[model samples]
Target: MLSNQSEVPSLGPIQREQAWDQLQKNEFDMVVIGGGVVGAGTALDAATRGLKVALVEARDYASGTSSRSSKMFHGGLRYLEQFEFGLVREALHERELSLTRLAPHLVKPLRFLFPITHHLWERPYIAAGIFLYDRMGGAKSVPAQKHYTRAGALRLAPGLKRDSLVGGIQYYDTVVDDARHTMTVARTAAHYGAVVRTSTQVVGFLREADRVSGVRVRDVEDGRTAEVRAQVVVNATGVWTDEIQALSRVRGRFRVRSSKGVHIVVPRDRIVSDAAIILRTEKSVLFVIPWGSHWIIGTTDTDWNLDLGHPAATKADIDYILGHVNTVLVTPLTHEDIEGVYAGLRPLLAGESDETSKLSREHAVARVAPGLVAIAGGKYTTYRVMGQDAVDLAVDDIATRVASSVTERVPLVGADGYFALVNQTVSLGEQYGLHSYRIRHLLDRYGSLIGDVLSFADGTPELLAPITDAPSYLQVEAVYAAAAEGALHLDDILARRTRIAIEYAHRGVNCAEQVAALVAPILGWDAATADREVANYCARVAAEIESQQQPDDEAADALRAAAPESRPELLEPVPVSTPVQT
Candidate 1:
């Protein structure tokens, strides 16, 4: 069956205002603060369960830690070493659900080869662990983990150092476009009649007697402050959980410590591997994840006590990741091989006196107050479970009885016909006059909603041209971001919607103007506004680059903090200059 080509449902201005008005009219069943994956998931869960829900985020959706991650949807392999069997099983189940049932289009299976250097004992031990991993909690979607000899392992990952491996084990996990998936979750919530708005900050909580009744929010987009009332208020703000708690004037039962993790992206050709590589490092595990035409290698987990908004990767952090990764490389990746760098803070429950690596990846939900519930400290894979738990707690205060969460059976917007579309990809590609690979990419990102994106190209074929700087992305995507994906700024389009910043060699500097120009008309930006958008994006990228060069968090945060504020007025119309007559 052909997919519906109607505008993919989103939060419109009327609906947003209606939600704000409803908060004044009557109390809602739930009000979720923070538009990260967890928050979005909570909103979806609550809304799907027949709760009157409203989700508010201080910045853009997933602007913080959610957007900046290792971009994997796997049960933590490292958690196995800590003997956290339950957490890994739960996360692995969720990973399978996302890949097969909920969001098959966004989440897909990825294979990783873990090379063993310690000969006999390591291979069997690791293989046994992977064998158990495959059998545990809904791992049936992908093939079982396979043990490989040195020669066999080299065939999958030729880039591994010849001397580094005695053997290897190939295992499967899943990866996602984190920012897009998070946004899609919020959109799905909107589709289910939840009021979702970004650039709207919950500045303070509205309390009744001793309970949180609602929140006082400031719309950063228009600079208007208003109150939103709900029977229950959920804090799903990840690293900012404590800050949200402080807003409610309630001391949280636990503290969340921010552990900064950084990742570097390079061209796919830099690493000659058909399968992703997982290498054990001195500090933590290193993953060379395959991402489209590029490879994402990352994650240095270090204590971060500086700025929470833009966590920067210091020179030391970069050196640490490179230092670990270089040890296992056939041809070492140097500074020149680095295309882009991004750092994110993991919200770990505080109480440990040990290193950040020792902190638990487990999540916690606490009823800190009568009407307030806070959920924090989990990896991205288990966000759905985290959201469900938070809502389950908040439901206690819900006046009228509501049905239990049906989100488990409720497929995300794109998952409905994703498998069928995948099966018929070749025919669809022929119909669109595009390559089957490109069609597959579109289907994976948009699923049944690919028709909406293709509709734009149908009217204006020029939109089908690939971006000048970031050739992997189409110009149609930038246009779609503004017109359909709720991208209000150039940063939203380039950084989150398209990932040009992390994939491009110049870090989206060259394409900023071109992208701004494409999105200008859709977002109502004039030449001056377009220029300002380009300038802000460029300055932000420059600041991030500068920040990464610093030695420590303090220096890095200070350098990165120099980024210009998001000013919509800068996108206002410019006066036309009069032409000179010769």
Candidate 2:
């Protein structure tokens, strides 16, 4: 048994073997494709149930739509309008589980203020809606909805226009670092003996007559290829579900349409609100979420048929969000206030309607072919339920009697002693010679894992210094990303492992060199490789910034697509030499 967090546990060489070895010996219960939230959860669900599972992703974990979501873990309040009680309840239960039992470190309760414009009718209508919302599944995890008059609401949100609301109702929901949560789920799956590998692409399906016997995987990092055989294969590829299904030569029961949602991040000082704000828009809902040190305002839902790899936010999208949000802001937010802009695609299941906004967020699972099960089209909140259902479908195909999913009761790796650690924040702060507020920040991000991070700082005093440009984050965290997390490239460190890419004014361009210099040794990168990585990351940032300036999605996608691919020198052998730290 692994005794310490630093001790790298053995998951068998085959789990990390080349594609040839995988093809040579392929005997598994299930092979799950995709490493998004749903896919990662599916792997954990299957593995915990005594199934020998292998999970593969073409890129980094949560590299697709999962990482680029609104990053909330709440029951869809809009779904209540659709009268989807079951979806809301299941999502709420999962949210509670995430916050209280599993991944408490990554998921925390966030309060939202729903502003009411009309005096009586709107107030009661919203109050009753929120009342039913509070009764859903995880209402007790946080404080119940509170009624506030216009004066009270204005006091809480001083940045709001006085006339925007007659009253307001504040309610609770969970928010998460969605990408990190997805990664932790994959790591948790690995901890439970699931063979999980990122940068591995599912090239094709291995068909034995009418049934899919296995998958042909290509190592996108290197140019190697292999085939992994399993009793069942599940497709949880999110937006890429249709492409995966086409490989098997089968018509899907349902199609997934991509809807692009864009968010703009501005400094918290710009919108002085203690709680997040939700307002109605002509097309859909607009949320001004309170992110750390910044507020995330967004989401324009429109059909996107452009590039799927990196959805670009057009000038029009930004203008729409800013225009709608500016309607209520006392100090209007313009393009200048935006520190970062991101666009993500939501895979909504196709319906008779052409309107992408009205498409179903509910997931669908179908046996496209014998031994092949595909799950697609779900909101991030209901990923666990989608995972459970996928695993249930795959279970029947297996010859052996598999155990039931125990994921509901299982706390994620960092969650076991989270509450106690949080309670001891004062003591921990004193122990580490840190302020209680800083300790609270660390605990919320890492939970008991904070101790392990602090241990590194205990020895290397230099690691405790905050990053040169981004003072909100410490330098040691970047080092930790290389040492602990499988951060292979500079993009992986800044973009996914940390929010420096979106959180910074320069979008991590200014801090890229320093971060690369610090992490180069840990990653065994030569000076040249380190420089290349930093350059690639800067180019990526430049591309995104340039893309957002375009007037339309088509033009924006072209501009963004022109950016250098993050994958540099794919065939370049892994270097053995390390860069000398300056």
lDDT against the true structure, per candidate, is 0.84, 0.82
In angstroms, how far off is 47's CA in candidate 2?
A: 0.9
**Model 2, span 432-455: residue lDDT tens:** 777888888887776767776677
Give model 1's TM-score versus the native structure.
0.94
Residue 306, candidate 1: alpha-carbon lDDT: 71
Compute each candidate's TM-score over C-alphas: 0.94, 0.94
**How many collisions per candidate?**
1, 0
Q: Give the TM-score comparing model 2 with the true structure, all chains together.
A: 0.94
| Cα lDDT of model 1 by residue, 1-582, tens digit | 112325446443445556567656666889999899999999999988888898988777788899999999998887888899999999998998888899999998998898889966898888878877887853588888788889998888888888889888888888899999999999888778788877778877888898889888877767778888889999898888776776677777888999999999988898888898888877788888999989998898889877787889888988888888888788888878889899999999988757899988899999998998999998899888998999999989998988887888877887787889899999998898878988898988888888878877877888888899888888888888777766778888888988989998789999999999887887778998888888888999999998888888889898887788674321211111223111
Please give the RMSD to the true structure for each candidate, in Å.
Answer: 7.6, 6.3
Task: Name the regions of candidate 2 deviating beyond 4 angstroms.
Answer: 1-26, 456-458, 568-582
